[model samples]
Target: MTAKVENRDFTADLNNKSSKAFQDFEREFKQQMAELYQSITSYRGVEIHSLRNGSVIVNYTVLLEVPATATANSTVQGISAELVTIVNSYLNCCQSNPACGLCFNASFTEVTSAKADSVDEDLCDGQVPEGFEDYYSPALTALGVLCVTVCDKRAASPYRCVHGTCSVERSGPRCECSERAAFWYLDGSCASRLSKLGVAVGVPVAALAVAAAAFAAFLLRARRQNLEYR
Candidate 1:
């Protein structure tokens, strides 16, 4: 999760160059790092460090604190595997696309693998594949948001229900009810049809009560009139 950029000589006159170039580089670098940070943080959650020697290091440390209920040991392994897939995918895209403007092609080669459970471990271990920068720069920038999305979804670990709905497996995969059905939560389960049935029965019973009360009142008024006539 860590990326290091060594000092590149923009020109011989590091001090004389228009402070503008340095400023621009700094701005762009920070922006890129921010994007990377956002992507990883959404997945494993992370800590970032920038060294004065022109090195940027990212640590995926948040996985350690995941609640036991939210994610188990198997889920952690799955998350780690998925992160490696995403990072490799980003690296591949950057290596293939030259116009991405990500200058550190060499750095892509250094990121080899990632471990979500261990904060101190180097995910890539400075062994990125060849041509990773050219393919991964634009890919990483464009799909960085997706990395977070996929990670979040995976953390939830929803599955396609048999009925074509999305269901999350807490204890086990359970169906997500369609909104078209009358929905209710009962006894740790969702009951979808009860609301409609309840309404159907309640409306008729209410009408019967009103009609019976009106009939009794009418009968009482008729008897009182006959007594008055007598």
Candidate 2:
């Protein structure tokens, strides 16, 4: 991340304080990296160049390492999402210390390397985890670090949905079946049609049974009237 000092007039302070500033910077940077990987680590390399508009450009690599919980896809996405805040907090460490007052604008980029190579968008076979409920964050996908899922690449197309549309959602692939017709399972099978057919057959059979009962009652009444006349 880059931090541009807000005040341009503090050149003397810039020269005098830069050494101590960056020393503290390095400490904080290493600390954040350790928190991530649980080991003492710093950036792989850094390059500092002065800008014409009283800004210092610091280019650095995060020096990726395999995390202990590297298999957790959410953790992978988290590091990618939170690294900027980590760097910014490091730059703004002076904020917590009013005696060393300075403000900076932070900007950074993510480099996909190391353990992030295993980021599967169809993680856990596309089953949504608890609490998240059908909403997988698009952070890894947006970062371009995604190992695209089968559905994502349309490899799972020609979907099983006979009467529905299939879509690749943030939660993974989904089927939206037409409710006006028979109910469709989430997996896109029209199994509900059989149930509807059963109900349709049952209605006529029930009506015929009722009609036969009424006719038997009518015949019994006629026989009683005939006996009365006799």
Candidate 3:
């Protein structure tokens, strides 16, 4: 993107054009481009600059990032040759079996980008998530990332925490609910509370269940004694 090779996206131009041949291959062209991408694994991507001259002329560039084993095999060049062929084929392809003059042009640009396997996993620059305010994520520096998203925990107020308190941690902000003795908060929001009446009623019902089991055991014992006497 920094290179800014093209003025604008040319695919958009083809989409707006009112040409019969363009309309015929519009869907297949996308599929063909995707298939082309699947073949090349070492390069950056195919940057389509513009598709002009009735969708027959293609202007594009492929960015190349050098590998550790540079040119060790012919995989890169072989695929590049196929890319040229496939792109040209898409340009001339039409459903009506009519000839539409099409040509393919590609520019190869070498970029000194990061290694293919090294991915930046740090999310220190990530934004404060929804329902949180006062984003204070540390900017990435040469040393390392200090912290990720840090919401305003000092005074999160009724806006962020509602009826709870907020605290910042490595994983971001957490909400601690504050509920009354006879009530408990629902979920972690602490906005809604349910009365402890159900808990109070459950105690006696559980005791009754135990008493019924004991009575059944005594009746079984009595029946066993009668059978022995017989």
Q: Which lDDT values do the candidates have, in the order given?
A: 0.41, 0.46, 0.48
Top-TM-score candidate index: 3
lDDT of 3 by residue, 46-161 (tens): 45444564324444556554342323224445555655554434433333433422223334222222222322333333545544334444433344333433334322122256
TM-score of each: 0.25, 0.27, 0.28
Candidate 1 backbone clash number: 23
lDDT of 1 by residue, 41-159 (tens): 34434333222233322222333333323234455565555444444344422434544534343433233344333222222223334432121111112212111111123322323
> Which residue window of length 10 is worst by lDDT in model 1?
133-142
Candidate 2 to truth, TM: 0.27
Q: Which structure is stronger by TM-score: 1 or 3?
A: 3
> What's the lDDT for residue 214 in model 2?
94
Among all candidates shown, the one with the greatest lDDT? 3
Error of 3 at 56 (Å): 11
Off by over 4 Å in 3: 1-51, 54-172, 184-195
